[model samples]
Target: MNRLTIAAIAVAVLLVTAASSLFTVQQTQQVLITQFGQPIRVIREPGLHAKIPFIQSVIALDRRLLDFEASGEEVILGDQRRLIVDSFTRYRITDPLLYFQTAGVAENGIRGRLASIVSSALRRVLGNEALLNVLSVDRLRIMNEIRDQVNREAKRFGVDVEDVRIRRADLPEENTQAVLSRMQSERERVAREARAEGAEQGARIRAAADRDRTVLLAEATSNADILRGQGEQEAIAISAAAFEKDPDFFRFWRSMQAYREAFSEGGDSRLLLSPDSEFFRYFRELPTVTP
Candidate 1:
């Protein structure tokens, strides 16, 4: 071969060696240097890193948070109720050496181990709680407990469990309809009690109103009777006073009133009496006047 071609071949080999010996550590990545499947050193800071071309290898790990989700699982609670729980976890690889030893350098292995740890934590913590507590507002506290437990177990795997949360917690499909029916029955019972209480109050108010109306009417009737009796007494006293003032005029007025009342608007009315009867006294003769 020519000298220039040999030099070109030599330069190509050097570039390949340089490329294989150098790897970039990104801001979001941590790397592990492994020799023949044995981790030798861990690189946490971000920058350019180097390893042996063929003997030492670089295993890049994500330094940022990772998400892990557990499959939906049915668990029995302390109350003997069944719940299907789906959970999610957020974690980070804290120690790359321990992570490589425990979970290997692959993402799948890390995820598998973490998911198992989270599931066990969930089962242990939630199994002791009643179903109501699992579904209540205190679920935040339950999640914290699960996180604490997962973190404790995850440290062995060089993982930091930042947060653990239940994605969904629900009854089995077979039990859903029964739970709905019970809730509906409870609501109906409450409605019935409310309606009964309202009707009772309404009836009490109506009865009190009726009693008050009856009492008011009775009092009004009694007052009217007393007024009528007083008016009749006043009329009798006035008539007696007039009669005492002039006996002849009073008798004449009384007889005239009786005659008018007996004949007024009575075209078919007739009465027969003696000539000297008191009822006909005014008609028998006119009184003489002295000058």
Candidate 2:
């Protein structure tokens, strides 16, 4: 090869070496430098960085907050109720060197270990909590406890757990229908009891009203009978007084009333009597009228 051609090849080699030796660390990334497949150091500052071209390689990891969604896990609560829990975690790589040693350099390398730690924390914390507590305002405190426990375990994996939260929690499919049925039955029992009590009250009220109406009617009828007896007695006394005043006139007036009643319209009566009968004495001899 000529000198110009050799020099051109050399320049190309130098350019390639220069390009391989340089790397840019972004604001959102942290890089781990490895020599011959062994981690040497971690670079967290954002700027231009350099390393040996071929022997040393760089692994870039995200330093910003990352999200991990955990698969749904079934847990038994303190109340012995089974729940399927779906959770998510927010984390950051706080120690890249430790992460490289334990979890390797890839960001995905830590997922398995972190997931296990999160799951363990969830089981431990939720196992002691009742379903009511899990579903109530105390859920925030429960999540904090889970985050703290996960963080403690995650530190060994070079991850700092920022938050842990349950995205959803529900009874298992088999238990869901059972729980609903129980609730419906309970409500129905309450309604039945209420209806029975209302019926009893209504019956009692009706009984009381019926008793009062019967008593009132009986009392009114008794009072009317008493008044009618007194009126009859007064009429008898007045008639006796009128008889004492004029005995013949009273007898004649009584006979005239009897004759009118016997001959009244719509009467169905046939009387066969002798002319000398006492009933016909007024007909035979008319009583004298007194002025």
Candidate 3:
């Protein structure tokens, strides 16, 4: 064949290749075949695909999961308390045709609408719980409710919501301060009460100890008195035993004691006595023993 004729055939082949032939679908992608802007087929399987290139355009869609992290939002709880709720969700596009029909485009299509829906769901679920519950244990239930509600609305958009979860849900900073102050006040009150109770207990213990001490001291004093009296009685009994052994000596000792007591008086201190007093016998000269 001539060179000109060969070059003409190559040009025609190139034009047909560009306008009427091949397509590619990846493992993580799906595609829609549109003819004159109208969807004709949905292609999910991956690899090179053939199409009427000029008559049909292939639009690719991702089949993998996507995520959206909701920003902090103010929500009212069941107890009429306000809180900031931040959350996130995982989702996937299940039906390309339906997704395109409802959401349009791809990842960009459903995000805005999903945000609105999830926000609304947050209000609906959290509204049944107190602010503390929203910040605490009931959070999981709220997430579950959001997922269910989101999935329900997503049917028309061919989007499947896999999960919804709380990232951060908390009271506002001002409200948190208020709560802390109230807690501190309550703690201080409790501390004061505890101290007062301790003081009262101390007083009771001290009173009981004093009463015991007083009783012990009184018992000791009474016992000492009894012992002293017994000691005096014992001394008198010992003296009586000595006197029984020698009556004359005891009488002589008694007469001497009486004479000394009667005669030995100070000038300022006086005593009255008879000259023939029995006490004089010991003091005066002894009588003669005449035969």
- Each model's lDDT: 0.91, 0.93, 0.86
Model 3 deviation from native, Cα RMSD in Å: 9.1
Tens-digit per-residue lDDT, 62-114, candidate 3:
89998988889998889988888888989998998888888888566699888
Candidate 3: stretches off by over 4 Å = 1-12, 15-20, 191-291
Report the CA-based lDDT of candidate 2 relative to the real structure: 0.93
Please tell me which predicted candidate would have the highest lDDT against the true structure. Answer: 2
User: Which one is best on TM-score?
Assistant: 1
Q: Tell me the tens digit of each residue's lDDT in model 2 across 80-126.
A: 99999999999999888888889986657788888888888888999
Tell me how far the alpha carbon of residue 100 in candidate 2 is from the true structure, in angstroms, after superposition. 0.5
Which TM-score value belongs to model 1? 0.73
Q: What is the lDDT of residue 124 in candidate 3?
A: 89
- For model 2, how many clashes? 0
TM-score of 2: 0.66
Please give, for residues 1-291, the per-residue lDDT of candidate 1 as tens digits: 999999999999999999999999999989989999888998888888888998898889898999998999998887888899999999999999998888887789988888888888888888899988988988999999999999999999999999999999999999999999999999999999999999999999999999999999999999999999999999999999999999988988888888888999946778897788878766778778999
- Displacement of residue 210 (Cα, Å) in model 3 is 11
Task: Predict model 1's lDDT versus the native.
Answer: 0.91
